[model samples]
Target: MIGFIELIRASGFAADVRQVKLVRHKGDDLDMDQLRNEGWFETYQCFQSKPVFDGCTHIVSVIGEDATASRFVGIYEVQGSTTASPALLPEHCPYTQWGTESRVFYTLKKCPGFEDLEDRVVIDWGKGALAWHQWLTDRTIMEIRPRGRVLAPFRDFLRVHLSFEDLGNLATQPTAHKDWVAALSAVGGIYLIVDSMTGAQYVGSATGSGGIWQRWCDYAKTGHGGNLRLHELCREDIARARHFRFSILETFSRSLARDEAIRIESFFKQKLGTRVFGLNAN
Candidate 1:
């Protein structure tokens, strides 16, 4: 087993090392669904009996045994001893219950493998609520791990296809994978949206401005592209669209005329019987 300080140094927090503190970050269970959507947990505040805080940096470790192997979340640069709620809590954080005092607030920057971390990280106890280990040093730099998402290397971009979840990753943080989005937007193609829940399929074509990326960005944003059928289904419960899986059914030249793209789209719909028994309205 690696010592707390050594493992963190290896994780690339060494440059920003400060004296380790006994203080721990406290918070309620992180929202798993939101983590799935955003790819990382952010700025969790902690309350601890004021430990002797020096200019040392702290490593935030997940206290719950329920937390997965990537138990370490991120590093914290806590300069203050008083832990007050942020000027504004994270939009999703629930209101604090009665009789609680703010301790030390921690910025829980997520580690490299945050997604695979075991599902639960709920708050418990009092100042002892969240368990944390601190490291002390006076390094000037603390680079955030995996600064941004890299495009998946799958041999060919044209052959690229992903589930709704994968697309969500791209949409939620477009800057992280601008290359992937640009490639998709550059080409027009025949695509299919499969409803994983009912095995229904919708055949559609992308053309002109922004190409397939534009079309998919719409789905990522509203879970529907203003399509009469999808709009109705999503309106009923926006989450219903989670059942939607996206993939390329076929490909076409961006230079292909709009008429030809439409013809190909219609052909696939007929071949797949989508209009008759699927999500396609037309």
Candidate 2:
């Protein structure tokens, strides 16, 4: 006989308690109806045999159907036990009466080549409860181990590697002058540029002082003549369009800020063509 612990809750009778059964086996078609009938009958027989103690009211079973299927097991029935009203031990409160409580009961079942079935049973129960019952299962079990050991570190590593790749690509771009301008703008610094009508090409930098917008306005007011590229492109039969707006894509933390800025400038230069500028350059 398997030594199993059944948890009984406080109710009208012992028959009101829920029964959970775990059957670990493979290739056997367990008839649900038969299990129910047999469980209830067994409870009745126990009640009849023991007049002093009332039988169980509920019975729940978790049976393993096939060994091959990933999840060959299932939880069945939260029924009552057959026992007298006002249980013998009133102080022994059940989980149901505690207003949404959970408990773990261990059963020592006798099965061939499966002495460790309890471990599997606990795992199944824990999973069914959506990991709320993890404490009940063995911590060392392979299936229930912490994800930090297997996946978390790898994910972080991947992210760092991808960021480096982005940085490397940025270093080769000439069109990224605008990105540097935007970065400078964020720090209250300015850049001056004359862009193609399409806003695709730019000549800009962060070395100059004062706000970029104000400086650009000053240049326009002084009649420095803007749109050198746009004018040249239009003369070549390229249709000129509106002035391009500069946008900041991202700001890096202080730790990586300098490197990220260089990367962005390089990436833009590579994408937009090499004719970008800074005050230090002629």
TM-score to native of every candidate shown: 0.50, 0.20
How does model 1 fare in lDDT?
A: 0.57
lDDT per residue (tens digit) for residues 1-282 in model 1: 335455455546544443554333333555333333343334333433343343545544433223222223344555554444545345544434211354454433334533422222222212332334434422222122233442242245445646666777778767767677777877889998887567988888998878888889888888888888888888988788876878887766787899999999999999999999987888
Number of the top-ranking candidate, with lDDT as the measure: 1
Model 2: per-residue lDDT, tens digit, 1-282?
A: 111222111111123222323323221343332333223212221222122222322222332322211111222232333333323212433212212113122212222332233223222333343221111112221232221111111111112211111222222331333343243333422122333233344434332233332333333332222445534544555322223223332333323344454566566555555455421121
lDDT of each: 0.57, 0.29
Q: Write down the RMSD of all candidates, one decimal each.
A: 11.9, 25.6
As a TM-score, model 1 comes out at 0.50
Shift of residue 153 alpha carbon in model 2, Å: 41
